[model samples]
Target: MKTFYKYAAFAAASLAGLCACSSDDDAAETGSGLQAVAQPQIIVSDLTTSGFTLRWEAVDDAGSYVYTFDGGSETPTTDCRLEFNSLERQKEYVVAVKACPRDPAEYTESPFTYIHVLTDDLEQLPQPKITLGSAYASKTVISWTEVPEAELYEFSVDGGEAATTRNRTVILSKLDKGRTYSFSVRAMTSDATRFTNSEAAQLSFVTSDADVPPLVIAPTTIISDAVAFDIYASSDETYYYEILPATTFAKYSPEELMTAFQTYIVEYAKKQGISLQLAMASMLKSGTQSLQMTGLTPELSYVIFAFGMDLRGNITSNLSSTQFKTTADGYSAGPNYGGSDWFTQRFYISNAYLAMTGYGWTNSVWTHWKGDDVTDVRYRTLTTKLFNQVFPDPYDRQAVAAFLKDPNYGLQFNPALLSATVNSADGYNGLTEGVSAGTSYTLLTLATSSSGAETVCVNSVTTKTSTEAAAWFAAAA
Candidate 1:
């Protein structure tokens, strides 16, 4: 039995090879004498919602027929018949059929016979309920409940091309910010031939708008040893406060600075004499004396803060930090100096006199200045940074005469500011030789201007070690 099967397989292979060669000869006769087969007559029947059957009359010498519906599967049938099932409902299709020769070597195919047919329509589908979801600055999400018998859904926006998805939710992106838009969705059957739309299900929504900030100004004037300035406001918006060295101020993130500023406003308002409401309102409005800040160091760079409030009470337009440098004697000249170096000279004597007023000249304080008042009667050495105000040359002597004549001229040397010490009994911590190595320093004094503003003065000086103190004083030797 095995030997017989083997012999049969050999014969089949040889016959196939011969048929291939004969077909090649027929192709060679293509311009010579080859004839075409006749087109077949097709009959359609057994039409159903899912599929249909097709039949064709047998042609002479034909071995099989090739049939297809709407360019679908090419079916081979020796009995001149074919059927297609599991198709879409309510859809039109064209069926085409052709005949092939019975001879194994024949390669020619007959011209196709075309016919039209329609699958039975199905019941109209029910529309799905569409809804709008999250809306952002430039995008939004849409969703719908799954519809019965739905294989897919069509989502559309602004009458644009539809996108098909099996998902119940879809995100629409690239929308214009702060603009209104419309979106809709519809359900379709498995074949997509039966579809229904819910016109009432359309949704309209607006995207969120971008943030825009308001204008604000920072502090610029220095009025005392502890630098003070007025912050102006325009409206009843809560203004935040921020203070940081100019060097590192820019490094702070916007959100971080905002948080810190809130803390500053709360803490600062706690120390004011007015009610919280008034303090906050004053900060929100400008030109009131309520916003004067003091107790800052001199010769330092600082960045001040201001910003507008939003309807939600959140910080907005938060990029409002103005940079300013405090006025220090010798470091910077103030309006009162009149370009006279006497202002600088007066700053030192006046500043030291006020700071040392209540404290007597003890061994420690005397040694710090490197001079004993009784022994070194004519002079004292003040070692400090240079704080020199530019002075008019001819009037330098006259400015000196004016400064000595003032009633408060010797007040710093007196202990008058404190009740424990009296100028009549304690006398004065007299004299000063001069500065050794000088730089700028802002001098805060007990003196007040005529308008009641604290007097802020600037001057430059040279600081000296006790070892170098002898060279500054006339009586040190």
Candidate 2:
């Protein structure tokens, strides 16, 4: 009898497909210059209560394909397979697809290959086979094989009011321990109207005896650069822990977090202890066991909290927490080599001058003017202006941009911008602080060239104020 019904349904669908093709053929041939391409071989692979899959042979020279489910919005795709979703449940649809060229100017579409498909009826949903699992001290787990057309399950305990759920399995919690309870379950349609079974499946179970909660020990060590810690469980049961910055912990109190965590565990676990055990194993294995904490920004503070479960189904009532600070940054000193004339920029404050003024420069010249801003004009103003004047043709800004982007770039400055001169004790060209008869001052010049050659010169300058001239001379001295 079932075989006869299956063949009759196939014959009806075939007849409907022929009629749909006959009507659509006229529409396919009526276009102006758009020649009809090859018809695709369509196959209906999968079907559900609200959707179906359609596949066809790939057409030669075709760039993309278009498909329509029951004359709805046309969707384009490059693949041969397409899935139609959100369809009207338990209704028949005339789905079609066609191939076309990529360019609109050269586009020529094939006559659509179509099929007739009927979604599974909600009233005819298949019955679910219920299975009972182990029961805990205050909980019992029940599961059912899924019915393809059912969206929810109707469950009841000991003739009580029916409860609805979208899950295939449910764990009844907070039940009286050592007490026996009867349970029944059935598949329900999405609309909540029709059910797969008129009579619900029945089963009985007894809760286990009382159990103890697992204990979690405090962490051993929390490092600065790498935050890590050790956690010990009372039993092999599961546990969970969370680490957050002090700023985040400040917003969520430990009590509030514990409540939320237990709520989630009760909803998902068969036994709270089992869920905690699994969570602890995963957290310690992935988060704490390896990194303790990974990707933590340096020089920051953080706090961590953890909860666990024992051999039975109990959860740790109180959460344990620990807080620590990351290490601070340190700057080490290095050699100070003066700037080159080939480069159009200068040290706003020369390393030699900075060293002499106790500005953290590594050079021994830091003995003079150990802490003074007397040479600010010479370091920040005249030095840059004089250095820039040496490069009449501006330095390559593009090269400078690349150098700024990546320090490892082979940075080379124009050699023509450099010049140097040296003075000797016999007749020195450089002087500490020279004053002309008119009260003008002499400026000391320190320029290093690209070839590693350095020069010293004393150029004359007129200061805006006599005090400024005296300051410059005093710094040079």
Candidate 3:
């Protein structure tokens, strides 16, 4: 008969050359006093980035067992299972196990059977120290302390496309006084084995203050999937604009929207190391400058927001906006982001799993979650590749994706999921880093009870490009 003692692979990773216990090792009958014990079949369970549980078949004559990790010292255990904990992530380990007979004088110890596996990666890089070196109406200079292993620096201004430099100091020029500029710098290395891109060293600085500049931003062209707008600064001025669906525009009050936009401006400016005064002075036009947007859904109404900068480089209170509808009908309207009302319930689920009360993210998607409000439960975040593989159809919110509901299968496919799992119910707050611009990620709740089902709440965000995010995070904000 085929043995039912099955050990899961990484959802069954190919182990063509790896060794396993032979059929002779599975015999149940005990041999003579001089006979040797046989190796046991090993089963892996609860595998996580930092730890895993291992179990072995119990031999008829075995009273205890010995196990060792890598070249570490052997430990004795009477049970058929042993667990490894607090191990390093993304590293491989060798587990060797052998059985000891109930009567050691009568039976010889069994030969060791081993399993080799690599842990998952869910670690984050430390943030570097960045400061505002100098601030002027024309430009701002920012420098970050060197990271020990960093080979280069990547920084962005006003949430713009990231730029790389080997030098510690970067100059951001083009001055408009009044509004705040945000700068974000990160340390990076070519070697991913030891490090990842660091969390941004973020700082916000305001250029010198000056008088107000008159500016108006209005859409000049509106097509089915694209739109173009004109930023009328009178001469040349600094401002930011974003587009939003009409429904999203209604969820927040005017004050809330203002605060949100202001936050975006500062966060973005800090990345680039330039103030609006500087950006506008150089990037803005002598008269009106036109910016074009494409890849929008046709026939949908969008609100265009124009945020002004004061002499202090702060967001102005008197924001201006206009509404426009696309001219043609070609593309489909994608999901509207922000607010819980837009959350996609992917499956039928009972409150059997741990869930987060709320999650917040930066423009760069640096995310943190407060623990589940009700009871303590475990949860994990998935990579974009695995997350999309699980949900192929974006429109199918009423899904019956059973594989993900199975804890073993879910963890196998998303090996890194458990690396970020939170054990606490009400007091845990953790930040999951390694987010980049224009990327999508999924978060999942793990089932806690045997009788309960898991929940997959995906909040898909289609962020604008660096060019646009640098201008603003969201129009509704």
* Total clashing pairs for each candidate: 28, 10, 28
| TM-score per candidate | 0.24, 0.27, 0.26
Q: Tell me, what's the RMSD of every candidate?
A: 34.2, 29.1, 23.3
lDDT of 2: 0.47
- Writing each residue's lDDT as its tens digit, candidate 3 over 329-372 gives 22212232221221122211111212253222322233233222
Candidate 2 off by > 4 Å: 1-36, 72-75, 102-108, 122-477
What lDDT tens digits, residue by residue, belong to model 2 across residues 1-477? 232244336534664556335335436443656655565566665455556666778877678887787788878888888787777877778767777765545546776666677764433344454545435554455666455446678999888999998876676777887888888887665543332232367788776675422332233322223444444344343556777788888888777776776666555555554564564343332222322554455577777667654323256446666566654321111112322333211121122233344332121110111111111111111222232343232243333233323434322222332222121122112122222211222222333433544333222222211121111110100
Model 1: C-alpha RMSD to truth? 34.2
Ranking by lDDT: 3, 2, 1
- Model 1 lDDT per residue over 1-477, tens place: 222233234433433443232234435544344464555755555555566666667787677877776778888878766777787876767666777777635446665566666665433345554544445543355656455556788878888888889977676667777888788777656633333222225778786575223433423234222323334444554455546778778787767777776555556667765555555555554332234344455677777666665433356555555566654432222222322111111332221222244321111122111111211111112222111222333234344334433555422423233223211234233233333222222222222222433222322232222231111111000
The TM-score leader among the candidates is 2
